[model samples]
Target: MKRFAFALWLSAISLNAYADSANCHQKANTPESIAATMDQALQLKQQLNSQPDPVVILVRQGQDMSSRHLTWSHAGYAMRQPNGDWRVYHNLNTCGTAESALYIQGLYEFLADDLVNQSIAVLRPRSDIATALQTLLHSAIKLNLFHSPRYNLIAWPFSGPYQNSNGWLLEVFARANDAQVWSRNDARRWLQLQGYQPSIVSAGTFERLGAKLFTPNVFTDDQPTELLRKGNVGLNSGDSVIRFIAHYSRAIPGCEHQNLGESVCVYLSPGAKRREKIKNRPSRREKIKNRPFYANRAACKSAYLRRQVVPCGPSSRIIPISVRRSRAASAAAQSFALRASRRC
Candidate 1:
């Protein structure tokens, strides 16, 4: 009984943390909140002053509360300014639309999430890579071209169809490491070759269908083909980005495991080692192309239509087999819907 109670308590704490972290994007506009946020940013900036490198990757928890496994959700590049202050450059969906814009804001504004806990992770890259990233960020044309207007919540790191906040950072990181890379697809391929695995967000078939039909910002076209085949999507989270950096780059001293206010700081060494080539694998579509009813758009639509039914009324006489099945399916769907809402 004691163990069960302890487990229940742990679950409650986890839920609270997830809920708080997930709503970090709702900005607090009060003067007191703004002042406190600025003070926290100033403290963080001061901590970065001792680092030798001029550029670092800044990570923060996300505004998505539904994900239990995700601790960090957003990331951006921080570069030292002429006056020795660090400014963050990243894409943000500020207008609550499917559109996002690239902005270079001060550390406070960058960390202005209403639910932002006192925690930030900083990963510093090698001098050469930092120079490359700085150069790319300084170019107005490059920023404009790379800035995606549509924001896809589950935007695949490799696809060009749409992008989320983290997708933009992933592309910029890829381009910084390789000058020859010209497109988002190329960048994603490069990261794949480097063995970067994005975090997976799973949903039931009904949940996915509902999201597709209703959620404008949740799209599947930009998802990797393999994930789409499995009825899942890849999300580029800040934790995943940090993992990629740690895998490829050395961690610098003094930047690892230091406490800054309520936040812990980690610093990575500057340069990334070259990754060996991964063996070629068949694309998701290619592997599933011959399968019967492999979720082609028309087939999916037909299946959905076949399962949709209205209630039998006094004016109605006979209920078709399809309608009967659909009614039964509707009952099952209600149960699943309850579960899906709880998960979200």
Candidate 2:
């Protein structure tokens, strides 16, 4: 009896150690979690298969700290595979690098965000649009041609030089909807004409300068003029993409406006009745007009230049000839620098 009790005590100790190790690696990509998520993905796949429409777009709030204010930050198209499982097609940046790649992954892999909180959004287009989007997806050449390796985090909605993940989806969406849009530039023009607004990140001049100097992934040329003029940069976040889709497509009944923390599943069949047509919301330009004058171009430019220029003072360094013209000029330069630093 004594020996048996000692054996049981040893077993308990072993089990406790195993539990501790598991807890330490809880956030790591473990096979058990992946398998569980796969099961969930299969369930979601079945639900999507029941929809009358064949294709739906998925949007999720990104896990990055920078994406906290945005409603959604990533998007991908989901479609049923030959085996009946659903797969997502989208572009992803190569681990914070300037390179990007087209990814065709399972729903589980698509939703594999470290900060995911058990919720996602689904956008189902009208039957005709769904068919068109699927048709475009079938063309490898068309998809590959636009798959740019240069990933710009701040890519403008209307730019062609570089593409962000959401920007790629936006371009693909444009091609799927319009046959005339054969190139990225054409797609961008279409989006601009439709008044599609990209999400704006409020970055001061010094922050922008620091990012440009230190990070290869931050590209500013693609930012929208209005946003850049206000010391902010435009980004193709998932929420903005969903809004753009909502502006153009009809949302299925019971599928529009999903509550937070609830996963959305939509089924669209050919015979399914179309929901109400989505109206175009106000443009970013219209919204910005209501903001304070400090967000305007002149103020932003002054603030930006001040941050870029070094301060003039004896404590910091010798004053430049331009700043040494007079005490008033030196004071003005110092004031400008201070304001710029404050903004930063």
Candidate 3:
């Protein structure tokens, strides 16, 4: 029996290695980047992804995500034991289980597909599950995704078979807006196309927004101030450029406003244009789109509400975003049970 068990264990190890190798195994290997601009791209990705349906993984990866990344968007599944040690399968890049990779599967699932047929990125949703899956397979071979617990409350509503369905699809795109991952202009434009006016976002409110996006797994919003340093977004609070974009986004948030004047509570993309419509003296268009990331509801609510109060007066209709968490999300919070079950 002992001998048989030993052989079985070894065989299991070997097979595991092979599977991981096949998944993350990049032949030419993925191109790597050290540029700060990567932050902007990641920020955009976060906004687009929003609170991930598979919440637990995202929070784990968000910590120190600023580190240089080796792409395995083409990489495949590598299941490293929860132990910190790394492993690889078959013959691929040496990838082990880390928080970044754990949650990054969600992000990889999106980028693995050719969102763009041409040089431009595809902002549209993909409907072909088979084609989409193929794109994912290709990407899995090239990227390394990880999870970091340092980032708090990564949303992961999609897990197991529940992922990839249309119902979850809406949740994914909605999350992008929730996180302010897309610049406000990009988010506004995208949402407008989908007839979705996502909640307003604020410059420095990721934590609060994180609450809404990730459920069944929210970590503490307790990253130290020093550790909360912004990535290389090349943006700062109150910049003249940001202010201008904010101005437009506020006006054309969904382009559904009944009144184009102060009665409108929507935001516009920087370079968005009006269809030669009458009224509104200033051409309601700009040539660029840039907006801040949303981290918290308070901050986001403030940004949009201030405009409403000024123009539409206090009676402006604001949509309700649950400040309270879902029961499942609250239950999954780390340490909540530990503290409760063993109260001193």
- Please give each candidate's TM-score: 0.64, 0.64, 0.16
Tens digits of per-residue lDDT for model 3, 1-344: 43243233223221222112223333332444222223333443443243221111010011111111210111222122233221211111123221122232323332222211101111112223223322332343322111122211111212211111111222323333344322323333443455432212121344333332432222223333332354111111111112222232222233333232331222221112242233354442421121233334443454342332222232222332233345666544323433322321
Residue 138, candidate 2: how far off, in angstroms? 1.0
RMSD after Cα superposition, model 3? 26.3
Give one digit per residue, the lDDT tens place, for model 1 in 186-205.
78788888889888766545
When summed lDDT is taken over every stretch of 10 residues in candidate 3, the lowest stretch is 56-65
Please report, in order, the local distance difference test score of every candidate based on alpha carbons.
0.61, 0.61, 0.25
Segments in model 1 whose C-alpha atoms lie over 4 Å from true places? 1-28, 64-67, 224-226, 255-344
Measured with C-alpha atoms, the lDDT of residue 49 in candidate 2 is 76
The residue-level lDDT of candidate 3 at 314 comes to 28
Per-residue alpha-carbon lDDT of model 2 for 147-231, expressed as tens digits? 6778777676676588878888888888887889988888889888878887765765666666666555666776666777787
